[model samples]
Target: MNLLRSQLGRPSRRWAAIGIASAAVAGLVVSLSGCSSSTTPKAPENTVAQGQWPSYYPSDYGTIVDGAKKEGGELTIYSNTDQENWAPIFRDFQKKYPFVTKISANNLDSDEVFQRQLSESATGNAPADLLATNAVQAWATYNNEPGRVMEYQSPELAKMPDFAQVMPNVYAISMDPVGLAYNAKLLGGEPTSIADLAALVSADPAKFKNKITTRDVSGSFGFTVSKGFVDGNTDAWASLEKILPSARPETSSGTQIEKITSGEYLAGFFISSAVAFPAQDKAQGIFKFVFPKDGTVVLGRGIGITPKAPHANTAKLFIDFLLSEEGQNAVSEGGLTAYRDSVKPAPGRHTYGEIVDQAGESAVIRVPYKITSDADVKAFTDKWNGMLGK
Candidate 1:
């Protein structure tokens, strides 16, 4: 469960080996090391009723795994997950399809992952078989460039809410809810809304000056989250701009968290609560978080099938595995908000449903990414940069 925390709005991933140990109980010893590609009994027909099943219940699990084994090509993955946090998911995947030999996983930000796929296409190559990213941002970054990402409708699509399923291929596997991360001792009191945050910083720019962390609105993650904030609240833009004068722009969430933990910074906006809270617990600091009452952007860590995947069948199987029930268990244990309501993400972490239940549906806004134009990106970039004299 160890994770090398990194910031969003930039390319990232670190290697962290996950050791799935076997149980000591005589009757139940589970091994996570090796899996066989050989055919097994056909899995049950899967049908997930909305709000009914805890995870994606595939009716034909064995069939998919066996078919993938037959393809027998390494399944290359470019994702937002670091190795340690992703090891459990890969470990479980390997256990189910040992015959595949290898699952090549490399972590990258949504922009970089898209660029790699785009570059591979230009060179008449397909090195990556799958992509796990922030779907909203990926949509903007890729813009559905031909041959970059393939559209394969997963049956699990029907199981998820319409909002979560942005494209046939780019669908959310996990939810990264944006929230406030503040040094409890520094922030006179927690700000509940964007307006509250604006007032807090504007009142005494001197105290928060250079101590408030934010992201430049140009990058993929920042752009997507900013769009959501602006769309969700009328005062959001001004609220964001007001903080710029006293703000310290950071590229990574980890850096923002580190600064706050060290008392160098008082607070940061849009720190992925799911990512920050866990690291906070481990660091044993006074760092705490809150879901913005006015609105909170929930970034979807989505997955897509590569257009020219060397192992197409294997990619499909891996996709199904990720959406499967056990996969959800891996996600929860690995540390992140579970995408589905039925999922019980690691006990302490919150579920998408739980967040929605407490914040109200209106408060959980998906990052607005449908607007993908050069002018739009430039406008956002210019506005942010102008504020900082960048």
Candidate 2:
């Protein structure tokens, strides 16, 4: 079977459906912000609070931070996270091990990173030593191509609480949940839940009819919402899509939160308090995050080792470092930790569980032991387009 063709089988235009929505999303942000009287507040520092993160994996053989044994090697990674956001973390890694040298990094979208890894594997020249991104993408890739990622099962893996340890190959160091975010001054405060918020939108269509925005979940969010539709919340999608004509799907949750704060968009969908709260706290735009009483989506960010990393040993060490308490804290940035039994995010618009539900990462749907299959990936893209009228 032609894997590439199958992967590309989904009409490209279906993927385009989301792009059309983005323009509106962007417009909503700009228009709403213009109406708000609030001023932007200062953002927070990157480090996480104390004792917030437990362990993402189990601690079978005690600690995973085996720093006592000094080892050295050059390593490289390719990712979508901008160099600026990631550079600090890399610097921290370097500070931990002054001996390692020649570290290289690249900034690219997850799709590009996945494609590059595939290309390298085809030519027996996988250059990067690590792979990291949001769980949905990584999970899909691993599912589609089992054994493409090396499995170290970090000694810290055992320390990870059960929910966080649901899958192999992909280990979460940080996570953010999806929920409704709104301008506090514009709507009194963030709605208690998505259902309530949706009701508010429907009741006064002119108020929020075209004021909300969302992220382009074409690959992951689409899969997430599809799974939600399949679940007992059969009406969840329709409930969600009911307001679509008025909703805009944007580039990311962060952008929507920014827009909402500025009063550009009064409300946003497919967002996590993780991004919203910080912005809200910074008083970026008088915003707040809240979950629908029913539930929402929880998405995680994590790291994985390439099956053919040039510096296998160093990559393994870095993975272990991240799973280590110190690294997890850095990733959490003093917010909600992803480890099992860890402290949950302070009361807000949503909870991690809500996101887990929306993203279909909860108890029912098994996160494939491997990534998604070539055929399935294509099916997902095509189905997304079908929904978008592509």
Number of the top-ranking candidate, with lDDT as the measure = 1
Per-residue lDDT of 389 in model 1: 23
**Which digits, one per residue and each the tens of the lDDT, describe model 1 over residues 155-177?**
66566567556565676667778
Worst 10 residues of 1 by lDDT: 24-33
Best by TM-score: 1
lDDT of 2 at 207: 76
Each candidate's clash count:
7, 39
Error (Å) of candidate 2 at residue 345 is 6.9
lDDT of each: 0.64, 0.52
lDDT of 2 by residue, 122-188 (tens): 8888877877655464456554656877877776667665545435666765555556678878964
- TM-score of each candidate? 0.79, 0.68
Cα RMSD (angstroms) for every candidate in the order listed: 8.3, 9.8
